[model samples]
Target: MASSVLQIVSPIKGAPKPIGPTNKKPMRPSNQLPQSLLDAARAIEKVPFHAEKHVTFQPPSRVYTMKEIGLEGCGISPIATSEPFQLFSQEAVQQCRAEIFSEPVLDKYQFSSTFTKNMIRGISAEDAPFVHALWKSPQVANAVSKVAGIELVPAFDYEIAHVNVLVNKDGEGEKAEDNVGFSWHYDSFPFVCVTMLSDCAGMTGGETALRTGDGEVRKVRGPTMGTAVILQGRYIEHAALKALGGQERTTMITPFRPKNPLIKDETVLTTCVAISDNSRLFYDYCLYRAELLQERMRLQAQWLREQKEAGAPFDTASVKKFIEEQREFLDTTLEQFI
Candidate 1:
């Protein structure tokens, strides 16, 4: 439960396979909007928008600051070049982008339509060098540290590099519309920093749009290569503009937050999504209990086999206990996901 114990297991190997709605059922087009999502988006429209710009291409980069952009306390910084930025190099990031697009994107919910594969590999803040470098930079660190009021530690922080590779050529036809663009939603974190790593080519329509409380829509052209944008992640309602000109929009979305040290009922991954509500703790606790139960069952099974091989009485009660724990843990975890 402690942060030290939850250090993310080494980054998972092999890119995650695309996820989609698994049910084979077909979906009907409905014009009606979900009132919940609509309301959430509308709530974002009530905040004011402030834009900040910084033109720098070198280390110790300067961060432009702004006050309130939405009720969530969002802000933006337009910087020239994030060269030697705290994170990955231009070339290294380009390679990551290339690899992300090399494969197909899939829907995570396994619903009727597909969701593009935007991945967050397990990068332990403790061991992540690029992240460490970035956090160490006076420019990047000072900004966040000022807000957090504590000197941030790399290993204890929660950070991930998000790579979104959009299709510019429009290959999937109708299905491409599913990928048109996501609706307005806030992240689980309180704030986020976005930086463009490469030039968006062959696309015309993809824009980063934000709405102020007065219903004014401000479109921030995502970063040009090496440019950075920062905003409050939990309060601002924003979405990617539909990609235009047949080119895929590519960008890096990174979020920073303090690490939760307690062993909760949810996995670290789910925590990132549930941090805003703070309800993720319950889910994490359930998940941890479930996994522990599973391991217990596996060990019990192995013990029973060993007893039988030795011609000793197998502990049938132990195996029964395993089955009971597995069922209980699963039942609890499923409820949270639902």
Candidate 2:
């Protein structure tokens, strides 16, 4: 089979360089990888992952609690455990995580990297084969499609799916309980996929916590080795359990949303695009616009809430200001992206 060719386009200079605390190397194209590695990625994309396993569906036990956790979808085990995982070892996995999370987004958002300083920055999907392998994996893509109920597309808006590593730089912090956890909020997309990368010795805590919008919470210990989870993105709330012992908690996040040119409320479609596909360049251009739009809407909503609270006239001028600012930001940002 011909190798998949992803023509990467960027907003600024040349291709995005590999970013991290220290690494300044520019990323090489996929052509640089060994042929066997490329073949493995392609092969995984053509077959069914988790074929031996049944889809595990979780129906809500209660119905009245719609205000809090308002989602409806089936939960399934992760898709790409069998083949791709066989290629990585613990040491190799950690190295991959270190390199990938060096991207700016994950490094800033992940708390463990914030407090202890194990984070890197400027990571792009273009730079990492492990990430690309998962993105191109048929097992993962198909699983996302089945759960999302639509044909998912590869995203190009951003590096949408990624991994997080919370390992100790030295052996002293290798226990599970020492990792930082995230706050409870549904992600921005319609579907979410998480795979546990490290589970054996010194890794503890870091259980997956699920919740409804109504505040019901359930905790499940993550799968060892190749175990994974896929869930509805909008309706359920989730957080990583606080790491307790001395180990670090590491996992990969793969989120899918509608293809670029998204219509509002289109998340109703389960399988969309993975958000970093090359086709999504235009779509990603729109994301900044959408974010600006959302910021304006939020300001309007807040103004209305305040007006009601204070028994005052609605703040029309404030709303107008927000719109103007949003427009300016969108215009400037779109020029850069396009």
In TM-score terms, which candidate is top? 2
Q: lDDT by residue for model 2 over 88-196, one digit each (tens)? A: 3344344344444443433332332211223222235555544555555665566555544455544432444454545443454444353436555544444555655
lDDT of 2: 0.42
The positional error of residue 288 in candidate 2, measured at the CA in angstroms, is 11
Task: Candidate 1: list runs displaced more than 4 Å.
Answer: 1-89, 95-120, 123-159, 171-180, 258-338
TM-score of each: 0.43, 0.45
Model 1 lDDT per residue over 1-338, tens place: 11111111111121112122332332322222234322432343111111112223333344322233333222222121111233334454443343322212111111122333333233333334443344345555455444333332222233445545444334543346443375565554435566665555555555666655466766655555655555543444567666655434556665653332211112223223322222433443444455555555565556666667777665566556555645644674565454
Give Cα distance to truth, residue 21, candidate 1, Å: 11
